[model samples]
Target: MHISEGVLSGPVLLSGGALAAAGTAIGLKKLDYDRIARAGLLSAAFFVASLIHVPIGPSSVHLILSGIVGLMLGWGAFPAIVVALLLQGILFQFGGLTTLGVNTMIMAAPAVICFYLFGRLVHGRRAVALPAAFACGFVSILLGAVVAGAALMFTEENFLEVTLLIVSAHIPVMVIEGMITVFCVAFFRRVQPDLLPGARVADMAAPQERNEA
Candidate 1:
């Protein structure tokens, strides 16, 4: 959901930039040095995923694995997403520098929200984790669409139709993302259970301890 360079009004741009700045600070602080590698991989994944855009209206539809990033990286998703978005803007000219902050806020805010909302359940037992994973990915996109649409509408009255188009076009995308998240969650649970949201700091260490016992 890129807002382009000049589409947003001055106040709207300022609001997005301010909020994104705050989120980046918190994300940087919350991110541990140990997770730098994980963050990098996920950032690259998001960068690739968001590039395949299907034009809907003023915005476009794409596979944003925002929930997957949030589920794994927690608050780190904000900074992670920003870095990828920055490169996309600079190199590929996907969103542009001026709209970088807004696009980051649009994508990463919902990610953080889903992290808090579904993170625990996804880390829980099997019965709940699978469903939670699906919901996390599904709901994040829906919420992100809403925020993107609202951001556009707040800038001007004519974007009401565009806002509607954004939401409607993404409905299918939500389902696709939900399934992808579920598959990834399940695979990680089997191969690297500790990496999936339940554990962070001692993820690998915990498995070693159990094996040693």
Candidate 2:
């Protein structure tokens, strides 16, 4: 969900900007060269998935697919999300420049959180991994909605209704994303387990032999 530029107060905007900067810095530091393409691909997916959205007051509702991003990129979600959001703002004007930081924080924060929460579970048996995958998607949306709501609330107390509406509107998306995550995770586990979080760089490349040596 993208929060409109003028909707947030100066202090709120500054705070969001600072948090985003810190997250992006950490994300960049932790990002592996081997995974750059993966991050770019996920960012593109996020950008496309959110292109079709329904505006609700200052925010919007759409498919974030953030769970998959987090599962695949972990801390790298910050930089990936920031890039997608920046492109959306510059190209389509879906979100404005001034609000970029807040919007990025709103979406990426939950993604990073989900990676920590459910990343390992996805590596477990089917019974555990499936539910964990679903939760990763479902909870990321829920948390994102809450974060969006909080930003609005902090901006102005009168936006309570809009905040409620934003959260309520995203309920269906939460379930849809959860199922999408489960399917994606299942597919990746079969064909490309190395793409998931915690996959070693050695595993990503050909451990048998590498030009890096």
Candidate 3:
């Protein structure tokens, strides 16, 4: 999902860089003090997960695990993902330094969106949470593909075919991520529910709800 260097125009790169900077600032501000340890762990998970990629045609699909990051860390995913991607870019050259901003946005923006959209459902109850977890995983990849594709199309009209092909290649990844998210969420929900953002919110709200009642 990384946009290679020199593919995007200066304006596109600048705008993406600006957006990523702003997002990273917000993410750092929003990081919970008590959850710092958990955030680091998730960051490590994200860093490792992307290493194993399945090359398909012109695009390579990998286990982003972005949904789990967002669902657990909220806006914190931006900073965490940035760190991981930075290391990946420097060490492995999976993506270039020039395209770091756009690549981070492509992956982390959808994660934040999923946190807002499906987070509550994932924390609601087991029956509802499983499906919501699945949806979060499924939708994040789809949204990331759309954003990346749109960015590419904006840079060059001729990239239409490549955009479509990349999007298509990730369809399998969407399903894989969904199933993985479900199992991961279920495990956390049972073993360490506090690690999840939704669970934290629900737990905090319970006191207020009970008092009001």
Candidate 4:
């Protein structure tokens, strides 16, 4: 869902960039130094995962582990996603610098929302984590599609068609992302359970002291 440079008008682009900057600041403020390294590694993993594409009927789609990132890093996923997108743009031109803010917001907003809502959905049920994570991934892609559609609407008259196409292209990919998110969450549950934000926050004080020590 990378919007190319010049796709959005200057005003929209600047406004989006400002919002992205604010979000990045908020995310950075909430980041725990103890988890920053892990977050960076996971964000890089997520960036690479996007390269693995699957062919659908008319379009190709790739995995975006935004939900997994959200589940692990909470609000920190914003800056993590921003860093990944910036690197992707600089290194591979996967997205353009002018459109970076719009693209980052499209992906990162859903992640932040998912991080906030997943806790309510899962409550104290460990079994719900995988499903919640999968749903978050699905919703994130849909939100990204919506943002792309909105951007197109400002430039192209056939906004509905573009939106439909983007959403349709993501259907199969969403399933794949969901499955991957579920599996990743389950694996983390088994191995580094503390890596998840929920568990980490519950034990935050101890880790903070350990890191300071």
Candidate 5:
């Protein structure tokens, strides 16, 4: 979902960059210093995850485990995604710097939305959490594709073709991401349940609901 440097006009690029900066600021303010180390580790994991490419049909896709990041980190997914994408761009030239803001927003916004939605739906149900997490993972990837489509539409008349290409390419990757998120959430539940933010929220909410009842 990377838009090359010259694809976007100056106005769109500047506006996107400004919005991305604002979002990053908000993400940083919400970030806990205690969580910084963990977020960094997850960012590294995200970086590595995207490198393992799987060819699907006429295109290639890679594991994005964004749902796992969102589940664990909450709003912190923004900066984590930014950091990972920055590294990918600088080191691998996977994406260009000029379009970094757009790319980050495309991936991270859906993650934040999925985090909140999944957290709400899976409250108090560990059994349902994995499936919800998988759905969130799949949806986040689809949302990224939509964002890419929108961006392309604004700039190119033949954007539908590009959108279809992206969506088709990501289908297999989304499935992989979904399975990985489910397994990761389950494994963490078994090994270090406290590490998951959604679990903590559910734990806190349960007692209040019980007391009110």
Candidate 6:
């Protein structure tokens, strides 16, 4: 979801910009060179997935695979999201430059939250991992909607209806994203388990290998 330019108040925009800047810094700090490729892949996925949008007032409905991005990249989701959003703003003008910080926070905050909440659970057995994956996706969208709604409301009370509509509109998307996350998690678990959170093959090497490296 993205909040169009000029919809948010100056204070709201400043706050969002500050938070996004901090998150981006932490994401860059935590991001290692080895995970750069995965981050790029997910950033591209996010950029493409959100390209098809159904505009609803100032916001829009789209795939927003932020949950999957977060599950794969952890705090790195911040920088990855910023990159995609920046490109979208620059190339497509889908979201304007003035609103980039708010949009990035809207998507990336829930992503980072989901990463911390469900990172470990995804490594569990199928029975547990599947549900966690679903929840991760579902909750990420839900929180995003709330954040977007709150931003609008804080900007102007007249936006209450739009806020409600935005949340209502994304209900189906939340479930769809949940199922998509489940599928991705399952597929990755089989073919590239190392891609999932806590499953990095390099990190799991034996103590001798670690010392040698």
Candidate 2 Cα errors over 4 Å, as ranges: 52-61, 201-213
lDDT of 5 by residue, 118-168 (tens): 855544476777678789878888888787777777777687898789888
Cα-based lDDT for every prediction: 0.84, 0.87, 0.86, 0.78, 0.78, 0.88
The 10 consecutive residues of candidate 2 with the worst lDDT sum are: 199-208
- Of 2 and 5, the candidate ahead on lDDT is 2
Model 6 residue runs over 4 Å out of place are 52-61, 201-213
Candidate 4, superposed: residue stretches over 4 Å from native: 54-60, 119-123, 201-213
TM-score of each: 0.87, 0.87, 0.88, 0.84, 0.85, 0.88
Q: How far in Å is the alpha carbon of 23 misplaced in model 5? A: 1.5
What is candidate 6's local distance difference test score? 0.88
Worst 10 residues of 4 by lDDT: 119-128
lDDT by residue (tens digit), candidate 3, 1-213:
678888898878888888888999999999878767778887987788777785656876668888888888889999998998988878887887778889889988999999999888887778999999999999989988988898888899999998999899888899888988999899988898877866776688889999999
Error of 5 at 167 (Å): 1.9
Worst 10 residues of 1 by lDDT: 195-204
Tens digits of per-residue lDDT for model 2, 105-151: 88899999999999888988999999999999999999999999999
User: Lowest summed lDDT over 10 consecutive residues: which window, candidate 3?
Assistant: 53-62
Q: How many Å off is the CA of 171 in candidate 6?
A: 0.3
Backbone clash tally (model 1): 0
> lDDT tens digits, residues 12-106, model 1?
88898899999999999987888788789878877787667755557756678889888877788889989998887778778777777888888
Candidate 3 Cα errors over 4 Å, as ranges: 32-34, 53-61, 205-213
